[model samples]
Target: MTTATRTLQLKAAPLIVEAEKEKKPVKVRITAYTGGIMTVPGWGPVIIDLQGLDLPQRVTLLLDHEGRTEATIGWGIPKTDGKTLVIDGTVTEATDAGKLVIALLKDDVPLQASVGVETNQYRPLKPGDTITVNGQTITVESDTFLIEGGILREVSVVPLGADKQTMVTLAAGVRNMTHQPAPPENSSPGETIEAKYILDLLSVCGDDMSTFRQAIENRLPLETAKALAETRRRPVIPPVLNAEVKDTPASILAAAALKLLGKESLAEKELGAETLSAAASYKPRTALDLCGMACQMSLGYAPRGTNEIIRAAFSTTDLPVALGVAANKIALDAYQQAPATWKSFARIVSAKDFKEHTGIRLTGDFKLEELAAHGEIRHANVGEETITYKVTTYAKMLMLDRQHIINDDIAILDQIPTIFGRAAARKVADLVYTVLLSNPGGFFSAAHSNLITGAESGLSVASLAEAIAALRKQTDADGLPLDLVPRVLLVPPELEATARQVLNSVELYRSGGDQLPAGNPFAGLNIALEVEPRLSNTYFPGNSTAAWYLLCGPADGSFLVAFLNGQQGPTIEPVDPGADKLGTGWRCYIDIGAAAADWRCAVKASGA
Candidate 1:
């Protein structure tokens, strides 16, 4: 018996099963153990000796290394075949788990095979050592080892296997049936093929277990499953047709945009090519043009001029939603395109509500301890701290009146929102920088052990070294070294050239007394330099172009910018302008808040 476990990858052939036969147990043959260099968790890399391979006559097959009886779905007989170990097994279709395995196999779902072996004879090999085994030369890189013998204790079917080369080959399903049934009809061939395709897609995107199970139970349509899978892969807020837009007018506008963007294929597929073709006939030029189109669709007649179109659009119930959709698209594009440097180094989270949210900062997990024979196991304590912040709304309104529509001043709808969108992005940047520049209660001072000042602290190789050292010296709540690495260098526009020189230059020479050339330590460090003009803007308090910061990546949890409901960007919605106001007004706002979460992940160099 062996104590050490090694995972090996092996190649497998596709599962082949006939549809005409009665359902029975699935026969499987797999290359259990492929002799080669494998990296074992906790033990590093090791090579199992095939000639010294030890195993029982049969071993139970489990699921993902679970030791319970319910996990044991089958058993296999193992035998040595050259450098590999092969296993022939039958997975019974009696149990639910067993039935699932068979069904997945029949649907062409790929399941990897892993074996849990215990190594009894093994020894660590020295670095740079070379040995010949299984007709291949192996070199020791780190903590490499050689296992002389091991027992193939158990086999398991897993979602992901350490070995990529090994695979479970399912045998052609032919059962010893007692009786034969009448042949099935082929009347529903189309539906059968569609169902099969959908099932295959479901298996491929089976990572979302709940969605996968739901799709399987309901036997969802191919398009619906595809949409769900695609949405699961990468979630994005579309420019239109999102949750906010539900009315017919908004849908029409969304469809029109989709048609204009040449993404008509999906729309055409879902809503006939004829419908899209008709929409293509009427191309809306301006806000007034869209209003006129909406009026015609809802009122059965197009308004005469821009004023009438705007009035008609404003009068309709769902017409504003359509106008809002177009405005939102413009604003969203601009907001995304605008620069927001804080995103580079600050963690952004979604706040569930406006109430004060408590964020738990777990310094680190408890270390694993050894247990003595019959000794009581003690629980280790974890280090944690709480930080609280709440999201608040910030907004302003832009009016789309009759004047702009009559004059056809497109900037009122286009460039105005574009400017506001960029401003919304800038607003977030301002809030994040304010936390540092304000330096409330000396947050970045010597007391915090993060601030470096004086003329010598200016942006340079030497100064950056000091800042990097400060950040790396940060410790967790447990008083252990965090070993935080600085990933971004934040500077004002005035120090952009200096920051680039320190980061990009291959070598440097010290000024004054020492003129000796030295290799730039910051070069090739992959530290990004982000220059924010607002940091030195006179409009802000404590404005200093000389101030620069070295910050860890966002994952380090140094600083945080939270959004209400995880909406990172601004939200634009249509607002009633009242009687005095002629046209529709749009309110652009963002629900967000920023605060210092962890002081250890950033070091400020006051370049005064």
Candidate 2:
């Protein structure tokens, strides 16, 4: 390759190096060795050689490989120099007269500078050509050019060096550059250097090979590790069956399985097998026999049979007992929490479990005897009267599909108990309200002589007081005063406001503008005012919205609401597998009823 050289002469002016505190440029000649690969600091590999020859040893070398020009510095390298050069200039005029008029920047302040141009062929300077002076580069920033006074070019220029200074400022504004040690040549990206070093150190410190082998062997497979963890988490339970038997019933097997599955009490091996056998087949297999056969088959100890398969098919899948218990709990909780609207007013009596409840109310009193003057005494005939109430069971069944159990969708199943419970409570309230409104016992009829009729008269103080007096005047079969006191005034929603007014007012107002001085004789009466929504609209033919009642105290038992003794609320029962038509369902039921016990305890006023 042929090598060429060109010399570029810079202005022989004082070049002050601010970083080195030097005042003047140094004279030096640099001889470049060409046509060879050389590595530059900022520029990558290039086909150029730089060799020989400079002046002061302190001067730094800078090369513009593309321009093929070497600029020598007297104090420091341009790359390393901390001082920045800013060229802000405008070329006002350029001429063939070898002079140019321009505006230049000194210390960031704009000033005028005259630059001389040397050309042999009288080449005129233009507005847009880039130029450098004293190592400061500038760009023609504006298109405006003016020629005056022998000047050929006039333009605005911005210093390019300012761009470099800006770049440095931006880089400094970002995160600090920290020098990180180079990674090992053979190591992967994620490999820990400290760990490798520690291992090496350990190997050098100890010569025990057995420990190293043990450490390697200690690493377990993922599956093995998981299995070990699972084993540790499982609770240990003692075996319920000590010896294996040849013929085990399906129920016994189920019970044993349940015990193993963490439900010991509900296992009920004997009872469960017997119930299932009685329901499923005439010759039923015992739970123990079926389960034992299954176990044996798993161990190759016995052959599989149709009966075993059937038993497995009916298996609870470890959820029956748990679900049953949970359902019972949910039902009981829902029952207790359900709103007791009418039940709150009626008297509740418990009935024997699975049996009818009887509420007895005595209507007649003992006969009073009169004294006799003769030797013989006179005796009055005694009479006994009784009213009986009985409650019957109301049942509902909910079915679960096989898919639900298989998918473990038990949350929906939990709602069954609560739904059943709330339904039972609502039934009880409806029954009580129905009884009161229907007055089936003639409690509100004229036969009972408690119904007061007058269409023109609405609920007024006089009318209510009359009703109360009539109730108090009621007598038993012995012709004695019932001694009854009105405890509550039951009214329809339409009459609730009128009832409160009549009971709460401190003074009574007459239709003729007359007022009673005893400021509301009903004040401090403490009589409970009850508004029954069911009574607002007509339920039965005579059930009137304008009707109201004066009832005896709750302790007097004018009305009786009865429930099964032990089964007061609601009960949830898991259906036996064989007997279950749907195969997956439970029964929820309640035994409750309500009736009017004694007509003497209350009186009704049919409001007009």
For model 2, residues 1-608, the per-residue Cα lDDT tens digits are: 83333322211122121221132122222111111222211111211101111111122222110000111111121111112222221111222111111111123332111111000111112444443322333333322111111110111111221121111100000011111222234544354435554465345325433223322233323333334334322221111111211112223333333333333443343235443333233221333333333323221122244333323333322123323444555676678798765543467777654344455545454555565677576554555455566777777767655544344444455467778878887788778778877877577767766878887347888888888788888888777887888888888889989998999887665666564465776788757887877676555444677888888776777787887653467765444333333234556777777877788878888788
> What tens digits encode model 1's per-residue C-alpha lDDT throughout 1-608?
62333333324333333332364677887666566666433233557777765565467787655444556678777777557767787787666667777788777787767666544345567777777665455666665657665555577676555434433211001111111111123322133435666568666667655445545544555456666666544332333324431223345654454454444664454344654565566686655676666555543344465555676555543355544555566676779899989988999888987789888887664555789688988675676777778888888778877887777664555566678789888888889888768876677889789999888998878799999899888887666788788999999999999888889888787678886757887767879999999889998898897989999999986789999888877776665465556677667778889888888888898885
Please give each candidate's TM-score: 0.55, 0.44
Which residue pairs collide in model 1, if any? 2-118, 2-119, 9-163, 9-166, 10-165, 10-166, 10-167, 11-165, 11-166
Error of 2 at 552 (Å): 1.9
- Count of clashes in candidate 1: 9
